[model samples]
Target: MKYQKVLIVLLTICFTGWVSLSCHTNESGGGELNDGLIGYWKLDGDGIDYSGNNLHAELIRSRKRPDSGSTNDTEHNDAWHQVSASSNLKMDDDFSISVWIDALSPDRDVSGDIISQYDVGRRKGFHLSLTTNPSPTGVGNSRRLSFGMDNNIASEWMDCGRPGQALLAFGLAEYNGDLYASTCEPEAGGAGHVYRYDSENNTWKDCGAPDRSNTVFALTEYKGALYAATGKYRVAGSSLPESENTQIGGRIFRYEGAENWVECGQLPGVEAIMGLVVYQGELYASSLYSPGLFKYEADNTWTRCSTPDGKRIQSFGVYDGHLFATSYDLGHVYRFDGTEWVDCDQVGQNNTQTYGFSVYQGELYVSSWPSGKVYAYEDIKQWRDVGRLGEELEVMGLIVYNGQLLGGTLPMAEAYRYQGDTTWQRMDQLDTTENVKYRRAWTMTEHAGRVYCSTLPSGHIYAYKAGETVAWRKSFPEGWHHVVVSKSANKLSLYVGGELVDQKSIPTSDSYHLSSGSPFNIGFGQHDVFQGRIKELRMYNRVLTKHQIDVLGSPD
Candidate 1:
């Protein structure tokens, strides 16, 4: 009888150990590290959660097919997988997401979301994606992998002081992790000098004027160097008083450090350089008053490229494998294919100019003048109205920040965030200078983790740190790359290819209760629809340790 009792106890102990081992063992080789794993999608052929959990995701197409040139492929544009909201998928505490991505059409002008479960209306949840938008504080190689969270609160704007006696902070750029601004100072003997922002002291350090021009019109980064374009801006164009300085300016200069710039030659027959961008691997510039687009060559030479409908192009952006240019003539957006230009036609019936471009929620969006409204690109020449900024005449800077699309407006100099379905929420009036005919929140850029906006009349820069974002400030490499986003305790960390790349601290008051009832998106979110292939997606209800993450990121 004693032997029988002992044998029964031993059998029970063995069975309990076997069950525990089965629960902890991961088929992917992370032994005893599968605790709190809620979902695991291999995405080999379908969205089946192979972790013995029945959280299957449904693939859905969010946009209608084009009337012509449809491929009818299963993974077409706007196609993404959706997992229904469930209690287990609701990350109300610590969580981790790991996935592998292979971007298909990676362009310098485009960005797309990888995975997210964010609600733009309520302003809550988390988002992870690739970002390539321009910010005021940082300049070159702006493409990065960004992970952000919405804390259900908007940050107040911080004043970064004005840059000398400048009337307008005409342009902003980020270069080598530093923030620089170009100004428009039309006073006699006051040229438009480039100033670097001193964050530690809340001041501006003059980097000297590149030319005897009223405005340092544009800034860009190419080949690991900072470049500035000059312009003789006429303040009377904005209904402001005419300047005493009238020097002709269409010069380009390369930064050689503090208070020094090297001339890179000037554009012939061009009085002002309106825009500058680095497309593909070359530098391109546009003329403000002439119908010309010039490409930089070796040894201070520039070759003029074919113009779109002989129209003047003012601002430039890249998307969908083509270089897109906004027109200063007919409110048209054009696409360039190196040899020729294809006009996308006018954006709105009444608007006469398109100012800037931004990517939001898997689509291209542009801001317009006269109407002061924003429009989303539906197809070639097809635009959907996205409402107008309140009582504003022109919208200039369009950028994506903190999982939301934001635009800066003229006249009122206000900023607004896009909610869903043509709704916009006013954020703040950046410039409060009164008795001015036009106050502009002119240019913007992102640096460090904050969105900075430069204002006209005041020339003061305002910064907003919305939520928390950690960005890998380099171009996402080609082929497949491993990415991990982990929110543990009060810290959020990003790991790329099994190495820690960037991190940011969550507010102590943040509960991080990401219980937004929105569906978990796999290849789409609040940004452009993902233009890539995703596989081996895993979500854990608990934070993943570095060792466990490294093992998963390793090759088989």
Candidate 2:
């Protein structure tokens, strides 16, 4: 229930619910093909491209998360990075290339190119991939399906397997010509099945679900057909309370072609419908425990429109033409002005929370929560904040790669790259974990020049293209060393003067996550305190082992 595949990886929206991030478009891209989207890259370790058309891609051997990259060190694959450069690239057919493949060793079978645009002798394009279908004990990968696609030159490869409890492919769509995905199994009673790959009989079907919600998360396309969105039903590890998150409420289905599909209703008892948008022409949907934004109109019907129920609308965007969003409730950011949804005022304060939504050149950018910053917006009200990824980071998805903006962060599942509109640049680290149990870096893609991310628990796959060498950091030990820190309720520790250095497992909140109930006083907050003074101090509510602070001698 902890993952970080693709490049900025990071997933575990509180475990149990399997692989996360339901679409994401810019609103940055949750896949309905971001128009001329081009080589987006979100891999941050830089492969260039930024979509301006430079088309970068190249990193073959990647590494980052070295020194304190410590996630208890299960570390095996060594390190990887390779944002493709060219198999000709330039793609079209409506585009649609999603990534975030962190699958270290479900026993192995495939996975090396998170977003490949093949030439295969001209059969050409497509490769959003992952593997694990062979078994006898050699490869069943928890159960199966780790996200698949290869039609064109790879001969034929249309995967959509995730069985053994499930967790793969959070979002990707090309509609009708085939290529729709949005799963996340986690051993439940149903909600996880949106496969469909047939890019010309390459095969793979399923294409169903969403009555009691097996977990469809999201799958775009809008005005013509393909439109999915549902919630609740995970069961694998567990986490349901939002009054059951959905008794069949927040749904939305449409497809109707091969395996059929239908439904298109829901949103009354509402508990989770995450995000979806088609803008001006039609289709809307978004919510989380009754938040707001529902439109659709005919067929199964829908109406609400604006927002106000409880607030939770996580992501959405569309610049210049209008409709912008971001809200984990208080982190606000609104903008829909043709009639309602105003408030462009919040960014991170009440517990942080606003989430990733992208729009580069035309403005709009989000991804919030205390130290993991990333604001931008512009008119209706203003909001800049810009740059961040440390004070306990938590950015989850965004894309505009190659020409700028690229983000994804959560408990260290890094990936940044904005260099301008407000500054940002790291790019890789799906693996080196400080481990806050790795939660939500969900999805942010850009196929062709490579740039994909789909992380959750360690399900890795990072690529950012073009010659590299960065990864070094983890040095420490310079001089004036006399530090000590500790925490409990699952653990966290560190020391320098008395030795010990580092420790892990704080699972979900602690280590003085800084809200300040007070007392650890030195110079007192602000400059980070104790530049030189502090003759003595001690505070112990509990958790002080190491022989109880080493017999307390140093304080003398």
Candidate 3:
């Protein structure tokens, strides 16, 4: 067997087997196989010659394709497989799944025998089309990994018309009542993509590719909004294929608590995206072409920094600094270089397919989308394959926060967060403002240890005192620009474009006056007094110096 040695080692993985039999897995499916191989046998034991078609099996992993970002390989891709009822793809309460697969060309014909539950003549259910190669759109080549619900199900399969070649297929899985899928490709020109099947309507909506010219590079759903990244340009119009695109660079889009996708802003200077991950604090996107990664500071503006040379960025997470990420196509882990991107000697490469990347317990983790294994590169060379998941688990956005590893699906509106233990939690329906009904937080900032989340589309700013919602908000001038606080003094001032508008003195001495609770928002702190986007805000404990106040109150 081509992978005989590796296959034996994989079959021995206890964690992989546990995932297959465990019922706790989240809806975004993918897991390893069990020892008995009764249920949905997760793709494990790499060398096993399942080519004989004796047992139904599935493989799940992340996707990690090349792009303009990192020269190194982060192995951030995921791959998985779905089998027939005989494959026993049922789950109980708690489980975790992961996998990796190098996709073949989309032109290759894959009969149900290679991926589905049926034999050559068995018309059991769905057909598996790995990659859509020689595609209509010349820009991005795509992969369609779908399954029909048995002959009775009428959903048509969007066949990619390719198979057996080393394309990238990460993984997919079903846990509890949720379902998850992923894919990986170059961040440039949106080569890789993903989609979601609305079981309620029996429809497959275009989750990633909004247009034909741009492919989906990264995707995630947070707080009810769906976030996706494309190769530096804004994508418009459906049905248009990426193959016709001429723009370079990348951009991120948001589907705010609604079905329609809205444009957020352009990704500063990023031309291509290798990986995207949310760690510690904010959203992070890496450029496959550029060594630098962009961090969402508040809204459109990003904190841009470059990675070490000889290595490109694949994925990112927050380890020690505010961020951490991996390099792909080249195998390495790149950490925040304080001022720029530097290689984290602490996190080196250990796996062959380093496609997907994340951070957990102050440790940097990388997943091999092709191999269907996850490796942790902490302080040494102890690389081990934790387990497997559904085939083609293309991990798009990997986040670790509040003691959990949150993974995102590319080209799809699915999100999953690991619940510390072995169980995975599905957060399919995020809080994208629908629950709020009226309030839509556009940006947030911290001042004097206090957090403030600004609500846009309504021009309201809400303040929190000691994490508790407060009743202070200040309205901005007619044209608010830099609504910032002075450095030396506690003065909140506003500057419209290149002119100072107003300067309000925050009573630092009189607790009673401060207790009265002024406006919590910068623009419109009082009533209909201010408008426009606030450029900046800062706060200090004491009164500011004349120079500091002037600086804060100075026009651009």
Q: lDDT tens digits, residues 428-492, model 3?
A: 42112332222122112222212222221122222222210111112111222222222122433
Which consecutive 10 residues in model 1 have the weakest lDDT in total?
67-76
Best by lDDT: 1
Error of 2 at 262 (Å): 26
Candidate 2: tens digits of C-alpha lDDT, residues 463-526: 4531101111121212232333444455445444555544444334212222111111112111
What lDDT would each prediction earn against the true structure? 0.80, 0.45, 0.33
Worst lDDT run of 10 residues, candidate 3, spans 132-141
Predicted structure 2, TM vs. truth: 0.27
Rank by lDDT (best first): 1, 2, 3
Worst 10 residues of 2 by lDDT: 132-141
Please, what are the lDDT tens digits per residue for candidate 1 over residues 1-556? 9999999999999999987666545534555456778899888768898766788989876663253233322232457788998876867788888998876544444547788888887888888887667432123235568888875766798999998778888788767667888898999998989999899999999999998888898888767678999988888987889988999898889999989999997898888888887767788888988888899996479998999878898888776657788887978989886778988889889888888888777777888899999998887778899998877888888888778788899898999888868777888999999898898887778777888888988888999887778777556766788999998778989899998888888778866788798899887787666766788899888888887887678876
Q: Is candidate 1 or candidate 3 better by TM-score?
A: 1
